[model samples]
Target: MLHAYVLYGVAGLMLVVRGIETEQRDSRGGASWNEVITDIGNERWTDYYIRCLHPDVIRPLIRGDLPKRLQDPEFRQRVSASLNLHATPGVYLCQFHQTGHLQPGDSQETADTLEQRRGAGLTLRQWLMVVDDCRLYSDVNNPASRNLAEQIDSAYRTTRATNYASNQRRWQSGTRQQNFAGLEEFLNMMDRRWLNWARAQLGTPNEWILDVPMVRAPAVVGQSKNVTERASHHLALSGSSYVHSLISCIVKFRFAYRFDRSVWQLARVERPDHMNLCEAIFSILASAYTWELGLNQTVSGASHQAGSHALTASALNQIYQQNRDENLRLGNVDKSLMLDEQLVQRIKEIKAFDKIKDQKFAELDEREKRVVEKGRKMDTAFEALMAREMSGLIRLQHRQALEASRAAPA
Candidate 1:
């Protein structure tokens, strides 16, 4: 079962979405009913925000199966506020658009700009999570997962200050910031390891990162695969599987929350000099969220006039590009069209042929000349195709920019 995560614009919260599909196989090879730690985001939105939002359902979900360290009342309160949409919109809620999705022209109300207000009957975040505490993999035998699990666990330990009372004080004073320096390092580590796969599966690599520092272990994520179908099928998807060999690895996955700005949220010009990975990702999502909220229109003092001409939505991608901050530029644009391995190969082949076409045309024998002629024709087709592909991306950018301007409050 995959681990489901839903981030709310309320309270910068990330909630697990579902209970898993199957339980464990016993020593006798029997399946039993194991109530895994269910994710709040996995529950039906109506059920979660409605029924579960009720004191009864929420009381149990919060009080149930919590980690020993996370079993306090403060943790329950943190999760509660995090899950509440009406009260807290942390950064921006990640959701599936339902039948009732709102469009730019359709929304005349300010509340319509909120992410929590833009879903179907209820908003659902598309993700899943499974629990596996099987002592199958340990530090000695499996350092990668062991290290990751510990790191995430440690990150959680740092969030003990995320109580309702303390959070309010910090929010008002902007004085408290819980630092998980290790989490930031962990994200950089992931960038180095999964840069290629991430680019292929997700949008342009490093463009809009969900810079997950250390995913809880023994859980697989259901996501778009950019690799060959064969490679994807042959490969198991898990935190450790990508980093190291997945055989006989006992992985454990856990959850943590922070009251302060430990989780970083980043954008084009918004990248911080130092921050937790969670905070960095949250920064980008928050930028998209603010635009989604139409709050970008109200900024004053300096940037207000430019706000009229300012880019919107995920246009922060363009904003970053305009500033020429090339290495760092991830946002909410789910760019499915990737210029990866296959396309690069084609571009290189066409360029090679184009380079030699004139020289080879004069000196080559008939058979060789014929080959050169074929390559020249292929290059023509390829170059045009590449141009069109690039042009399409430019058009997409234009469209996003136009939408941003249109969505801005007049």
Candidate 2:
């Protein structure tokens, strides 16, 4: 009776697992194994292999003897679901509300219940159970399982090759810097192409900027004349939206450069080096962007305040009189102090940054000089060693010749 009950229990478990897989197929539209793995991400996968996966499961999966119960299709589906849980554990619950995880007209009560369930991320044992199942279910014909196993090996190799400490040592000795030359060249080409595209759009006749001035100058602010035409033009131009799209393009290019496998593989070992020239350039660009943003905000606020009152002739006369009175009162004020404080502060910050950058450049130059001097000393020693060895060899040859001559019959 106990054996029969055990059989029934196993069958029930299989049924539950199979049903879950069916639901996943319906929800995911039968996504391929590769797609699922990609959704997990190479970095996460690497982390799983290196730091998370159980050693017991690893050996069985490696040896092709993983338990069958662990290999059920439900475990595979859960792998991707686990990633969703890892990233957004439905902590807010409202996050899952729009995700259709809750049915139509479902109250916050229902969402809270769902969040409770979703918040429970995959634990280590559960992940190991999946691995064990895959190992047992995996065969030479099980391409999905086999592919995952292969990825584990690939991740291991990548992680080992890109070890931070080893890469740093190599970099300090100036070993792996040449590896990035090709990648740098490719990025430079990409930059030039993007620059040309941006120049075409923003320069010579100035497309978007011109559109703004052209429409706004002709239209009277208070009147509804050409209202429809002006509105349409404004909508079409998107009001400087195109001007900011360069930011997105720049961001996309940066991510593309970061994740390109070929380029990443080359420098994978060398963690992020703040002393890199590229780092300096990026910092400068970011500072400039921040300054522009502050300037724009200040101008925008001032313009809004100035434009708040209607500019009737009497209002303008009043404004002029007020400005004259203010100017007379502040006539002896230092021009520098009278300037926008934020602008002055930014200038001071920039000068400080320039000084720091110069210091760093000088330090780098001195370090290079020391490295060069060290190399020269090593070269001189090497030359002296070679000369001594050659002289000793010649002396031995001469002594052998004299001894042979003396031994010759006369």
Candidate 3:
């Protein structure tokens, strides 16, 4: 009797394993294993958005064709109001049509206009914050529009005052003569570093061409020996300012481009190359902004330098953290685990068992949460490893420089 009981126990264990395998196989029926594998390997929210906006295999769904459930009337109203779409419907429509996205048009011209507007807005907001962070625009007697207009006026005055001072210093020194050279230097540095960093992050060298030229003031008035010198100066200053403004706008445009590219890459279920590119660009921008704020402090001779510095630092830190979180959320591991017949069979079996039992035991929510957490941890670890690698490279470069210096008998 004891021998018979042992044989029955072994048989029961074998049956249980077989049943589980059978259940898995049933659940995965009718599903494309290749697609499942791709989804698992390329986990990214941007990928969904990219496909929705610019699909390849299936022509992109038109905006009008989007499901009603996805279109929130209230959100659309808010966006319309904030963007002043009512006043510029045609312009916005043309922009959207050209860019192939529903988002506000970010064409080169539009970007310049937006930057000018943004600068105006930022100046007004900063002034209001100084007056009263909470109730700066709460006066019933003063129209909000009028208040904003006044703030912008004050800000421009302040900017002009600072610019005039700088111009005076340039005139006093021989530096004014070299303004064109300085502009060239600035443009060269921006172009070289921006392209290099962009290429590194994209992992596709030579994909883009940096064709924008260094801006310079127009030749002196009547230096042409034909026109009035005063008029020429006016034209030169205006032209130079326009060029500077456009370049600044391009910087913002590049930010938006990378954002869109990241989404596209995700949609195509490509590698994490774009994420790396986004991170690198964000880092460079943060570093540049920090340096600019420091220079602002030295030039302004202001007591609130520390506070401004902290604000700028916080903004950069926030951007970096946000990018890191996004990268973590989008990254996928176990990509090597392809969607083969075995995996498909296993999934099918699980689904069939759940259906037969009339009670879900797969615990999909729990499983998904565990997977996401694992991916986040893996991303963080990878970032840390890269940071260490960069540090090592820097040290090696420093050592090489030191050896060269010693050998040169400085």
Candidate 4:
């Protein structure tokens, strides 16, 4: 006899975990072990890892650095489907639909049901899930919200539909206010005929409110010869449909510099690679990521082993201090490096991203390096200890990933 417990099912508006029920079975069988560890089980770092690793690991993986085995078409699809569920469970059911867990026409119904949940004041992300998972518009779902999600979705569709989507796409994330340009320059480049028409209707563009997002729908009192085109022109001029082009000034100019394996944490949003940006990420991993070990700080580098040497924080600190130099401090580094010189270069290059259109990524790939590597010389012993501990963490929990993956719902 085996048991099958329904955690959530399509019995009502929102599926709540149902009670367990047992049934007889000749052999015990269920989801694979990998599914359980990665999706179903409460394995260590399995939950928080995705959130923390988004900018660090997931970004790289998304940019085509996934493990070779996971690169297969079928495996990639599985990973993508798994990502859909894990990114926003219950709210996002793309994987369910793909796996025959959801009926063909259930997406709209789910959206309607989820729309009410959004009306009660869910987060922006939650509202976005409805937009992505359900066909319902935010305005249609709840007019009170000013249809922010719906409007954004519509803008995205328009942009993506236009040739501009590929033309104006950002190469990567973590680009925070590096450029310096005048708003007048942007206005000067606009189509003169269109701008003249817009000026006649809306008057002079207020420099201050130029970047402010227009919340309400565009108004066209009476039809003109080119009314539909004029409406688009008006919306583009006054609304936030293309605000990115207007906002060229720097918003935040915080410093972010990286070495061979260290990142100076100047801004919180600037996530650094855990392995390379050693200090910024190590503290979090050491404190939060190692909770499952039960050996918190006890055996940081296998000191508990019968014949191995014990590692100490003081020793690691000495190594870190030795490698880091005067440039480690913000006031001591170059202005260019501080501004993330590589990122600035990438943005400039990507602006003319069409220059090398024949090339894969259009020469944008070479410019994505945001960090300046000075190759700080940390003590070999310290490096060995860090590597050993991190490897141990992964190796120790490797089986859990397999188990959790298998345990995940089909």
Question: Top TM-score: which candidate number?
Answer: 2
Query: Across residues 1-410, which tens digit of lDDT does each residue of candidate 3 receive?
Result: 12322343312222332344345436654333322233223322222212221121011011122223124576434222222222211100000001223245558776654433221111211212222311222222345523543443233332322223232221223343343333343333333423333335343432221111111111111011222222212112221222232222222232332211111101111221222222222222222222332312111113323323222324433433443443344352231121222223434443554474453345676688899999999999999999999999999999999999989954
> Which TM-score value belongs to model 3?
0.17
Least lDDT summed over 10 consecutive residues: which range in candidate 3? 89-98
In model 1, the Cα lDDT at residue 251 comes to 19
Counting only residues 3 or more apart in sequence or on different chains, how many pairs clash (N, Cα, C under 3 Å) in candidate 2?
Answer: 5
Question: Given candidate 3, what's the lDDT at residue 174?
Answer: 33
Off by over 4 Å in 2: 1-339, 408-410
Q: How badly does each model clash, as a count of residue pairs?
A: 41, 5, 12, 22
**Winning candidate number (lDDT):** 2
Determine which window of 10 residues in candidate 2 has minimal summed lDDT.
Answer: 213-222
Question: Model 1: per-residue lDDT, tens digit, 117-159?
Answer: 2222111011112111222112224555455444433433323
Name the runs in model 3 displaced over 4 angstroms. 1-179, 199-410
Candidate 1 is scored at a TM of 0.16
The C-alpha stretches of model 1 lying farther than 4 A from their native spots are 1-42, 45-109, 115-181, 189-410
Residue 24 in model 1: shift from native, Å? 25
Q: Please give the CA lDDT of all the candidate structures.
A: 0.29, 0.30, 0.29, 0.26
